[model samples]
Target: MELEYDTRYPSVDDLRERARRRIPRFAFEYLDGGCNEDVNLHRNTADIRDVELIPQYLAEHRGSDMRTKLFGHTYSAPFGIAPVGLQGLMWPKSPEILARAAFKHNVPFVLSTVSTASIETISEITEGQAWFQLYHPAEESVRDDIIRRAEAAGCPVLVILCDVPTFGYRPRDIRNGLAMPPKMSVQNILQICGKPNWAIHTLLHGQPNFETLRPYMPAGLNLKQLGAFMNKTFSGRLNEERIKPIRDMWPGKLVLKGVASEADADRAIRLGLDGIIVSNHGGRQLDAGQSAIKPLASIAESFGDQITVMMDSGLRSGPDIARTMACGAKFTFMGRAFMYGTAALGNRGGDHTIAILKLQLQQVMEQICCERTEDFPAFLVRSEITGSAGSTMSNR
Candidate 1:
């Protein structure tokens, strides 16, 4: 049976559902859950929904342009694929699939430090369109070695994740017995068996080994022991002293992800970071944290001139991308949403996710009478958010 692309998974929710059905329970929960109570996860999406857009009418909105310039390159859309760890676990060869898709669509696909594939693999797959996100191991030598690998792989940008001071206490993971380097269990085996397609894909590919970690990992360890090794090896906390070597060594645009406060934004600027993602690790780290969009306007206002202030966390669609742009983010990235697409459709996931977001953004641009990407910030109304409604203001 031939599947129609348009009708199969129209929305992110639909893709998420399909992904849930196709992937194992433990893997799905790990991707979906946030820290502790998951208050911040709910808040991230809710807050984005709460802030409504005031559509402008009676303006010649012909030929809306979604093109955006960031880090000295023009992107088809303002959004890019965010770095998600253990992508192969979500779906077999997910990093390669996503990187190829992003390359075809002419957008960025970030590779996580803990991802199954290494920068070199992604570099080949993505044709250097893949950006590397470093978790910054506790040891300086380890960090330096990783940075050298990224540079050698032709990674144009280095994204240092700054907010993972410690691993979040996700109850979902605890309940599912899920963490990095997943262990095999009867329940997990049953779940895998239920999705024979996924199981076959994984088996044919030989268990989705972490090709990136082959150099460091010990021999003869199963997935469970690998998990323990990773948990013990990498330090969750990242600081300035740790960042100095990376900033000094990497010859590319440096970004500090997981910046949620003005203090952190200020620090990013001081450290000479090329950009900063005003994210709370997609609300995965702090359950009570505010939505990534909420602090963006203020942060952009304070430091947009000094540094690039991009954002991520709760962006669901193109309109959501527009809304975040209206708030303040120079560019946006989506992690779970794209992963949902990849997990939902396997080989076809990346293209479908990009297609959906591009169409959605085009619709928002047309409705809002926004002709260009830069013009969106100008139409954003700051006062309507405060109350009386219909009050429009220029960019703050």
Candidate 2:
């Protein structure tokens, strides 16, 4: 379909800047900052940008088509909205807005387990087209119940997270009262007061809560209690033992997200996973980890035939999407970019961001004379960068 987006904000950087100005400082930092020094955070995008695609203008090309097939569904684009927790905190009703847009755009929207909207709500919004991501719950009963809820909601895919065995030490979140034993401070209140637009919408929507986990949480729990509850509830660690039961129970396409190594890719295949998302939790968990694209190149080359290889974490633009695909990522997803859009433009943010990404990708595909999304790898200009350990990443 022909796309029309806001000309004022043409890129994600523009949306991010606007989002920063529009939302409170703490919320923006939570969405924007990475763990520790953010070394991996900046490296994610930088390494991807270093990847060059060879344009073949002389080749015969009818047109470019971005339609991509994955897990028995053909999507309009190769990219989807990666799961983001507490989306409502970033922008009220942001998850639902993005879910509606994803459904309309014929792309997947993976709802985070901790997102503001419940599975049933998002499923209703998308007409059972949305996917659900599973965070590791402590009890088998809770895990099974949540999986059952996802199945009942008509979730086509169950993406289980593997990267966050423990919470990353984000100094920004700790200072902003987003960490364990969270306490709202006067400084945070003043920042919120400064952004009247954000404050008004937040007030209108009510405070963001873990809507999906509300059943398990006690009523009227304070901020500190809420943090304690979360800590006690989710173990945040996934091993072969934990995954076996979920794999047996879930009757949908099973995906393992936060894969950053070839051994883990092999493990996913051995465990009968339908796919693996080559990610580093968007550089949120480990500051010392390698950029997702670096491992993606090896993982895709090694296990692409055995299991689907998709990627997230560091893709910010259409060209970035093209770069990852050229590096062997079967499909791509973006988290902060979509959140930035919703926080910046309110309801129209979802549609506008999707439109701009689609248009941007179309331009790249046509310029490279690539007719289909699957043809992206043929246009890749392989370059190598050696790591500190002497291993090389072809993605560079």
Candidate 3:
């Protein structure tokens, strides 16, 4: 589909700035901030940007093609939308907006278990092409029922989250009273009032709810009850015991997200998972942990052939995606980037962000004389080699 985006907000940074102005501080911080001090958060993008690529200006070149194959499906682009919870809180119907846009762009959109939209709704939007990310409910019955719903809706992949054994200590969330059993304090109300556009849209669309889990939740529960329900309902730590049942039950591809170490990658292989997304939950779960790229490089080196090695944290632009690929990621995903888009531009956010990323990535491919997404490794600077076969010391 042809996408006409707002020319003014061309970059992800621009979208971020606009989103900050448009949404309330609580919503913006929830979408943007990482755990304590955000050191790992900043480090993720910083280190990924440090990767250098050498352009082959003299080489005979054809136009770039961004098409990529993953899990037996050829997507239009190498990157897809990472699942984000409470998406509608950021922008009304943000999950549905992204799911439809991803389908239109021929890229995958993962639906979070705690997202504002339900499984069946996103499946219908994407025509059963969207993937589902399971938060691993505390009860087996709840987990099985969710999986069954996804299966019935014809979801192609089931992504199980492995991080977040305990909630990250986000000071902003706490200060804003956004934590479980969220308190709508006066400060939050004043902040919401300042963003009239956001407030109006929220009023029009109705308040954002955890639509996927609404059936399981009680009606008109207070903020404290909501917090208690969330705490008691899901288990964040994923182990072999929890995963084995999901693997056996999920007929489609099973991917383990939040995998950071070679050990976890190897375990995923041992557990017979279809793929492992090398991520640290966008640097939100661990404040002092290594950047996603650091582990991605090692994991891709050791297990690239055995399992599909993908990554998600700290990627914001097309060049970032290219950088991750050069470091040895087979595929990449983004969460906050798309949210920033929708929050900044409302209905056009998804299409606009995807178009911009596609353009930027294609430009990188053409500039480097790389024909396909998989060939990005050949342009990586030798010093940054992650055990890939195509590391080159010379720029020539």
Candidate 3 yields a Cα-based lDDT of: 0.92
Worst 10 residues of 1 by lDDT: 386-395
Error of 3 at 153 (Å): 0.7
Poorly placed runs, candidate 1 (over 4 Å): 1-5, 180-182, 383-396
Better of 1 and 2 by TM-score: 2
The TM-score that candidate 3 achieves is: 0.97
Whole-model lDDT per candidate: 0.83, 0.92, 0.92
**Candidate 3 segments exceeding 4 Å error:** 1-3, 384-389, 392-396
Output the worst ten-in-a-row residue range by lDDT, candidate 2: 385-394
* Tens-digit lDDT string for candidate 3 (38-93): 99999899989988888898887877898999988999999999999999999999
How many residue pairs clash (N, CA or C atoms closer than 3 angstroms) in each of the candidate models, in the order given?
0, 0, 2
Ranking by TM-score: 3, 2, 1
Clash count in backbone of candidate 3: 2
